[model samples]
Target chain A: MAVEKFLVEASHIMMFARSVGDANQIYYDADYAKTTEPGTIIAPPTFAQSSAQFDPDYFLRPKIGEPWFGSGKEPTGIKRESSGGGGGGGGGLHAEQHFEYHRHLHPGDVLSATVKPGKTWEKESKRAGKLVFSESITEYRDQHGELVITARGVGVRTERPVDSK
Target chain B: MALKASNLRVGDTHSVCIVEDLKRTQIVQYAGSSGDYNPLHTDEIFTVKVAGYPSVFAHGMLTMGMTGRMLTDYVGDGRLTKYGVRFTNQVWPGDTLQATTTVEEVADGIVKLKVETTNQNGVSVLSGYAEARVD
Candidate 1:
């Protein structure tokens, strides 16, 4: 996925920090932040994942005039040709995630993300059946064209719903 | 405050209760902010009837995000240079989570850590490692 522009604003960081239950002043209180080490409000560690908000073609978000996969009047808004798969309730599950921070983000940083597909592999599991995992690596760059963070994620598609036990 | 290398030990550990009784509302909040509106996270009917899960579950990123709070609180804000994790189990609503980080190594002004998050039942849900700059 390529996102041309991701505006990192203070409110978004505050909301993201709240959603994750982080109460750190550096994440929300700019006044308090000025006295701290960073000397400014900083984004949370995992905040860069929200770059999906700027991805025009991000499939997980419902686009206008597009039929979503979630429920409407019925159990699902879209029809499925077959059942099963999606262990914890989606097309695929996040198997792994990794991030390397060249620099942390603060409000007002305009960023962009470029993605590269990494690897694909398969594994058999007793609880989830056959699992196919694919990886993607994303590089986030600030407006200055400096690489800010590198993210690697692996997604797994299971043959059937995973056994909860 | 940032960790001082001189005061750190290889096995020094810090733990925090990341979330208690994880709520679906919080999951929705994460979905809204993260822009990952996957039905498996907030749409219980579709998740139960179509996707065949017991119920809607938390996004792996949500768990990671919450765990990140623990990391930053321990290592100090903006101190982390690397953080990564593998989802080992599903996190459902009503589950309490605890995250722990152990110092694995500290050298050259950087500290390496072993990170693990577990559910109330002591089942490991996420496991990984992190590296951070220290004072």
Candidate 2:
């Protein structure tokens, strides 16, 4: 996903930290952060993935007038084109993710992300059937045009929903 | 508070109970913050009737994110240079997770770490590696 502007703010970082159950004061309390090495509230290691919030066309999020895939009145807001695949209904699942941080993120940092398709491959698995994996690489650049983080993500569509063991 | 290369060893390991009794609400919180509102992670009806899962599950990134906390808490804030993970199994509600990091190497002011997170059932949910700067 290409995000022209991902605004990093303190409150969002705080909530992101809380979601992962991280209670480190350095993520929320600026005063306490001053006593730390970074000298300010810094985003968590995986916080770069939150750039989805700034991507206006991210499909996972429902738009104002669009038909979403999630449940509503009829167990789903949209009609299923086909229900032949395994568990996630071929909705795709996160397979792997890697991040290279040139620098940590902090409040007031405005970043932009550019995505480049990486590779596509297929694999067979006992628990999930045929797995189709595709990768994408995103480069996050700060307002000053310095590359901040390099992220590689792999998404897979299984032949069937993976068996929860 | 960064890790000192002088005190690190190849076999040194640190582990933390990342989450206890994982809750659906926390999953929702992650979806809201990360903007990954995939139905399989939040909507139980869609997940069960449509997606064909037993119930909603946690996002893989959520597990990675939580596991990341264990790394930062051990290596200290803003010290990470690289962190990555592969989702091995789905994380579900009520599953307590433990994340562990083992020092694989220390050299030239950098420490390489092997990371893994497992559910209470002793099944690995995520596994990967990380590298960080050291004193």
**Clash pairs, model 2 backbone:** A86-A160, A86-A161, A87-A160, A87-A161
lDDT of 2: 0.93
Tens digits of lDDT, candidate 1, B1-135: 999999999999999999999999999999999999999999999989988889999999999999999999999989999999999999999999999999999999999999999999999999999999999
Q: Write the per-residue lDDT of candidate 1 for residues A1-165, one digit (tens) a residue.
A: 799999999999999999999999898899999998989999999999999999999999999999887899999887775555556345599999999999999999999999999999999999989999999999999999999999999999998887875
Question: Which regions of candidate 1 are displaced past 4 Å?
Answer: A83-90
Q: Individual DockQ of the candidates?
A: 0.82, 0.86
TM-score of B-chain for each predicted structure, in order: 0.99, 0.99
TM-score of chain B of 1: 0.99
Error of 1 at A59 (Å): 0.7
Cα lDDT for residue A31, candidate 1: 98
What is the Cα-based lDDT of residue A18 in candidate 1?
Answer: 95
